[model samples]
Target: MMRVGVISDTHLRSYDRDLAKKLAEHFKDVQMILHAGDITELSVLDMLEAPQVIAVLGNMDGFAAAQSLPAKRELKLEGFQIGLIHGYGPPNGLEERVRREFDDVDAIVFGHSHKPTNYLLNGLLYFNPGSAAGGRGHPKTVGMLTLGDSISGEIIEI
Candidate 1:
């Protein structure tokens, strides 16, 4: 199985070093890390410390940034087609949006709600890791996905 650490919505002027260190230590065996978006800056990605990091650029990202991040990205992990985006607003019609963006996805991960969630629908697992840096009345946290030809995730509070 491949353990992947997931984080999102870190809009702070500075990242929490302690949290990063702890995550690095606890997820040392993880094969990769993913940041859903609203990162605001490239330094946020540097703090993750995971060898492999997959991320998306949210509305808050500046143009002409060096990171070459995409607004959406589809990745094949193990045997699953996973799609990612930084979803804001209500969940209604959100699935359609994702489907339109990545119709063949087997799983989808998103953020921008600042509320953690995980659900299965139409055989698709939709997940939101919440705000790892904490704000807007949301708990600060991250996530982990243990995958091998399949996918599942656990929300981890930062």
Candidate 2:
């Protein structure tokens, strides 16, 4: 099985020591890391201890982040296709909006609402790790995905 760590909405302007430490401890066993955006600065990605890091550009990202990352991504792991994106607009229809961004994917990982979501919908797993920076009155959080015979997600508060 392959384990993937998921985070989003860090919204940091520079490196944060406390956030980094929390990330390291939470994601230490994962093989890959996925940042769902609002990262704001590239230094946030440096905190991860995972071997592979995949990220997208959030609406709040800085120039360097926008230049280096895509607005959306599709990746396959352990025979499952996953879509990663920084969702836009309001939070109500966020799922439907992001769901249309890709096809034939087993899971969609996204953030924008700053809310933690982990559930199976129409046979697809939609995961949002909330705001790792704990902005907008939400609790600090992250997520984990275990990929083997099926894709599953768990939201972790940090």
Report the number of the highest-lDDT candidate: 2
Q: If scored against the real structure, what TM-score would every candidate get?
A: 0.87, 0.97
Per-prediction backbone clash count:
0, 0
List, residue by residue over 44-153, the lDDT tens digit for candidate 1.
Answer: 67777767998898766655332688888898888888898887556576655665777888888888777787778788888888887778787888888878766888
* Positional deviation of residue 61's Cα in model 2 after best superposition, in angstroms: 0.3
Off by over 4 Å in 2: none
RMSD of every candidate to native, in Å, equals 2.1, 0.8
Compute the lDDT of residue 80 as modeled in candidate 2. Answer: 94
Which candidate achieves the best TM-score against the true structure?
Answer: 2
Displacement of the residue 42 alpha carbon in candidate 1, Å: 0.3
Show pairs that collide, candidate 2: none
As a TM-score, model 2 comes out at 0.97
